[model samples]
Target: MNSEQRMKSEVEIWKRKMMKKSGMMNRITKKAQDKINGLIPEKAHKVITESIKKMVQATLFGSEYLTKPKETYNLSLEEKEALIKDSLNKFRKTAVVEGAGTGAGGLLLGLADFPLLLSIKMKFLFEVASIHGYDVKAYEERLFILYVFQLAFSSEEHKKNVLETISHWDEVKGELVDVDWQVLQQEYRDYIDFVKMLQLVPGIGAIVGAYANYNLLDQLGETAINAYRIRAFNRNEITEEIPLDSDK
Candidate 1:
């Protein structure tokens, strides 16, 4: 198979993984996360959800200034992805540097990494959309970016649902008018809570922060690439069949 065909095969594998059932470790994690969440006050949850909602909205609407001019419309999938790889590398470095700097500052600066890393992730997604020949300026495309974010960090069950939406994005895009901000914030926070907590440590914070941010960007890069790949296939009427079994 050629490069594009190979990429399609890889996307197939990713789709199956996305739809696969949560493993033992995942269940354990979810159980712990749920218990911890239950201990937190409802008011605190509301505040956090609202804060995340506002932060995301501000970033989404204000990110146009951060986007580069699109020049990938004429490029093939392989070529566009080559550009995306370059973009991913650039963002990964930025995330790592920011993570280390903030982590070194202990609790105060470690807290700052949340918004900083979030902006970096969203900005990278915007650029990826551009690379895939999509208009990030459009409302639906921006919403799609949020779904991509959710898919990367949500629980197994939620991830499957988001994957289904993404795989058939064109058909379902009209129905998705707004995001479930509470779910978004909760899932994202729970997903990274442990590592981020470690990033507040006095001595090891720098190393943990740098490592966590690098891996997070790596995960985001994979998700963004395949999410757009699924869209590409959908547009061409070549979408793959994702397994629906709930068992690993």
Candidate 2:
């Protein structure tokens, strides 16, 4: 079989191996704990806090792109279909407005993050780029929205333009409140990385993430698979390593 098929088959195998439910939950819980701890420092607070905030912003944008409007709200079949069609259109529009090609600038920093990316520590850059599932030019526009949410812009025009673009994205983004995020704390890190992996495998979709996650859980004993997956993605440490915020 070809490399892609081989890898896909291997993933399928891994899923089958990790099929136990309780074992998977334990692994997920452990992974969540580790991620939360990794998000903060054992003793220091300030630097890790800032870093956590930054990662949260990235993760938020990463996950927000996946959620949909509540279906519990009453709607006629016509309304539901309209909503589905509209959501599809919005994504297409997003693909266009944000740019589907490497150049569309979709919703990303347009051309700005490129230089900014160069200026920052390379490892963080890779991590951030991995937030796009290791696809930079392809997802530049979408990544731009995450940057807008987390960083300071040089000009008001840039900020306003980004805000407008975000405003125009009619599909549901994320939960309305912080508490909503708390509801899924156990899957937080996994979910964040799951979104990135979903971007990597476009056809997999959110349902696939769950399937993959649960499948992996059964196979890999419930721990988060991000570290392993990142390795699989071949994300490398920068040659001239940045001191990872010097707080870890």
Candidate 3:
């Protein structure tokens, strides 16, 4: 296959992976995650929720500290991906350092990691959007970032719903109401609780924090790449023959 065809094939593979049905293990895990969430103190949950809400809002509304959107109209898919990979590497290192520092600092710094890592994640998302040729200054583009965030960190059931929404975003974006931040925050918290809770432990928090943050950024990077690829494919910007199985 030629370069464009190869790119299209890669995107199709990603689409199939994204659409794959959740298995029994996924259901059981969600249940277990929910149970763990229940065991957390109510005050702790409230604190996390409020912190996430504020961080997300600030990022969405154009925090000056975040990366400005780059002009990407002339860049090819390969070029954009190269730039995105570079950004991902930089952010991954930053996360690892932040995690390690906080992890070693005990409970207070562990608590502080929540908002700090969140800011890093959000900043990376905005950069990814710009690299993919989307203007983050637009309100719709910001909402698209939130959808991508949800896709990365939500439960299987919610993932399915978000995938559907993103798949038809061009049609529904205009009619959509504001996102329910409460639900979004809860889903994100539950998804990450197990890994993040481990980051709060005294002895292993540093290792756990670094490892978890690195992997979390990696996961988010993959999700952001594929999400933009889906949009490009749907818009015929990257033309390739659809696989026979795509209609199934």
Candidate 4:
């Protein structure tokens, strides 16, 4: 197979893997997360929800960390993937280090990890958007980033819904209303509750934090890349398969 064919195959494999039905473990975890959600105080939940909403809004509209969108139309799939892979690696390392530092600092610092890690994730997404040639300054494009974020951290059922929405974004973007921040915040909290809670523990928090953050970034990176691949494929930018060794 040629390079383009290989790339298409890789993307197909990723899509199938992402769409696969959740297994028994996933269901059990969902149930556990639901119960934990019930135990969290309403006040605490409200605070977190509002905090995340503001933080995300600021990041989406802010120019501080945004990069100039690349003109990848002239770049080959292989070249684009190389840039993406590099960005993902850099973000993964940053997340690991942030997780380790917060995890080692005890409860207060571990608590601090929520916003810190969030910023890292959002900034990484912005970079990914630019690399994929998506103009982040556009309102729809910023909304798309939220959908991608939701896809990465939401439950399996939510993931399926988000994937469908994003897959046909052009059709749905017009009628879309404001994002349901409440639902978004709740789902995110539940999804990470178990792992993050462990990161608050006194003894093993550091190790767990670093490990969890590393894997989280990896998962987000995969989702971002495949999500953009769907768009590229739809636009016919990645339709033709060339020889693996072809310079063109």
RMSD of each: 2.9, 20.8, 2.8, 5.5
By summed lDDT, the worst window of 10 consecutive residues in model 3 runs over 238-247
What is residue 19's positional error in candidate 2, in angstroms?
3.8
Q: For model 1, how does the per-residue alpha-carbon lDDT over 11-48 read when each residue is reduced to its tens digit?
A: 76776776677789877876776776666556545644
In angstroms, the error of model 1 at 142 is 0.4
Per-residue accuracy of model 3 over 8-83 as CA lDDT, tens digit each: 6776776566656668977786677677777766766777888889866875675543455678878887789899
lDDT of 2 by residue, 168-246 (tens): 3332224222312222222323333322223223333334333432332222211112122223323333122211121
**lDDT by candidate, in order shown:** 0.81, 0.32, 0.80, 0.79
Off by more than 4 A, model 3: 20-35, 65-67, 237-248
Give me the candidate number with maximum lDDT: 1
The runs of at least 3 residues in candidate 4 whose Cα sits more than 4 Å from the true structure, single-residue gaps closed, are 31-47, 237-248
Q: Over the stretch 65-94, how does candidate 4's per-residue lDDT look in tens digits?
A: 577898887887668878988988998898
